[model samples]
Target chain A: DAGITQSPRHKVTETGTPVTLRCHQTENHRYMYWYRQDPGHGLRLIHYSYGVKDTDKGEVSDGYSVSRSKTEDFLLTLESATSSQTSVYFCAIREAGAYEQYFGPGTRLTVT
Target chain B: AQTVTQSQPEMSVQEAETVTLSCTYDTSESDYYLFWYKQPPSRQMILVIRQEAYKQQNATENRFSVNFQKAAKSFSLKISDSQLGDAAMYFCAYRSYTNAGKSTFGDGTTLTVKP
Candidate 1:
């Protein structure tokens, strides 16, 4: 389980509304990432944070924003939710001495 | 950019038997890392196994092992003594040794464990 948790496991909201998803990790890993999972796309990274306040855009960063103000808590926000953004979101953490990444349970979001 | 390919979209394996999932990758770097990730219905992504390009010996984790063919740019996962719990969506991933944050993943192979 990796002691990782994602808030609002499931959410259904109308378009043009704002949404935010939170990911909390007890492991205090150095790296955190936000990804979206779709039918044929598998998992695509949206954004990643190497350290607090230091983030970078991933392959699919449009329409999504992330913030890591402190360790253990990473937040993903959608300024204006759209139907195309409806998908499962996953958060992952990479530890210092390990090549593997631990993922959170995931948050399923649906935009109407 | 690194890319991983999982040729098998779906595979079925009998319980207590063995199955192999094929994975091929494209990368210009000589040193990199290959990984196999399993995502069960629960939606948690777990690392099944990992192989380092610099190491000639393949990496093995209990019932899961990888065959790393550096020359062929292929890294396949072989499951021995398959169990019902092994049924999941398997994803092949690639990461450059120099960078740990970026990872490229395959579409995924759904493995069904036949009883």
Candidate 2:
């Protein structure tokens, strides 16, 4: 698809349950990022990966963990989902050190 | 660390007219990049325009152009002959050199096209 795909486009989960969102990219880009969009706050970076096994946290990384085991896949895990975690999650990919990015369609997660 | 700021929370423009969305950023590095992304109702983020800090010339894509004022640390998007399809949320973003490149996004401006 020459694009990024986010799995489970829409999800409904109960609080205290673990949820994982997967981001797969056919572009094989070295830089991958996860961001959450909330009302008023816009998009805030949760985590990002520069390469396989090279990941770092962004401004709002609490309660979220990410792993980049391969260049094509970046996984975001919510150890225990909460109502406040309900938001649209976006996955983005770009070449190393490039500003231009291609984003996935986004995943809408709801915690009840 | 770099920060991107989009001042206009919402804006309205008539079809076939022009509208400008304002943005400003803060960074200490000399080399960086700025970008604008559009998110439609589908929630798909698409790249609108991009500019490299080293380049003095503004980057333009069709009717979409950026007013890059490096001295003022300002980057504004101007859409000319706006179309109904242009109605969406426009996000201004900034990326700077760190151990790895990390992008910071603005609050975004919702542009409404009134026909």
lDDT score at residue A103, model 2, on the 0-100 scale: 86
Q: Candidate 2's error at A66, in angstroms?
A: 1.1
For candidate 2, give the lDDT of residue B79.
100
| Model 2: CA > 4 A from native | A97-99
TM-score of chain B of each: 0.97, 0.97
Clashes of 2: 0
Candidate 2 Cα deviation (angstroms), residue A101: 1.2
lDDT of 1 by residue, B55-107 (tens): 99999999999899999999999999999999999999987776645888999
Deviation in angstroms for A27 in model 2? Answer: 1.9
Regions more than 4 Å wrong, model 1: none
How do the residues A1-112 of candidate 1 rate in per-residue lDDT, one tens digit apiece? 6888999999999999999999999998999999999986578889988889989998899999999999989999999999999999999998866788888889999999
Candidate-wise lDDT, in order: 0.91, 0.91
